[model samples]
Target: MSDSTAYTESAKILLLEDDLLLAMDMEDYLLDRGHEVVGPFGRLVDALDAIPRNELAGAVVDLNLHGELSFPVIEELQARSVPIIVCTGYAELPEVKTRLQGLPLLPKPWTAHKLSSLMEETFGATQEPRDAPPSKIRN
Candidate 1:
């Protein structure tokens, strides 16, 4: 996976997960796959603010962030038609099922392979710029 040829057009992806360790790992994986990451934002407010500022092609979102439901973040992304892949441990929550019907949902403890594959399917081919470092939106 060192080569970027297999990735979809280099797209900016929003990462909304609260766990520091998990977010770091995901950021590394997305960067390795040639996608610019907007933020591994721990707070929903931070992620929501970054959304309007970046041109996000897709997202990997967590259902709960530090105990708060992230429905507003999901809805904002939905309104923009940016593809989303929900990555959370709380997938069984009724609100998750009700609001995010039909979207891809990858449970917690997922592999980098599963995440990348879904991203590829959603965004098509990842573009080159192989040497470019992945970017992040800091707030």
Candidate 2:
């Protein structure tokens, strides 16, 4: 697939994941793809706060964040018509199936390519966001 980072320049991405390394890696990955990535946020409140005020194009969310499932955030994103992709390592996919129906659910340890493509696919190329190489950008 073409590097989705090309579309990143036009999309404001909100990333909510608690795993610090994973979050940071994804943030860097998104940055490299040229999309505006808000936060690899580990907290629900922080994510909730950041998503609305900004002109969000889409998001990649962790199903479990700091012992809290992301149902509420899903609701908010759905309400706002913001596209979201779920990333999780837990086995409770069925439990959250209702809220996550029809959305991309990327299991843990996913490829950077998949991540970037999903962002581009979700938001399209209309809206744009700040793009630059993060301190670290993995191939």
- Candidate 2 residue spans exceeding 4 A from truth: 1-8, 125-131, 134-139
Model 1 steric clash pairs:
7-126, 8-125, 8-126, 8-127, 9-125, 9-126, 9-127, 10-127
For model 1, residues 9-96, the per-residue Cα lDDT tens digits are: 5677889999999999988877866777888899988999998787777889988888898889988988878888898777777976
Worst 10-residue lDDT window for candidate 2 reads 1-10
Across 1-139, the per-residue lDDT of candidate 2 in tens digits comes to 1232233353677888899999988787677666667776888888888866766777889999878898888888877777788897774556667657788878888786666566556666332333555432111
Q: Each model's C-alpha lDDT?
A: 0.77, 0.71
Best by lDDT: 1
The candidate 1 region of ten consecutive residues with least summed lDDT is: 1-10
RMSD of each: 5.4, 6.4
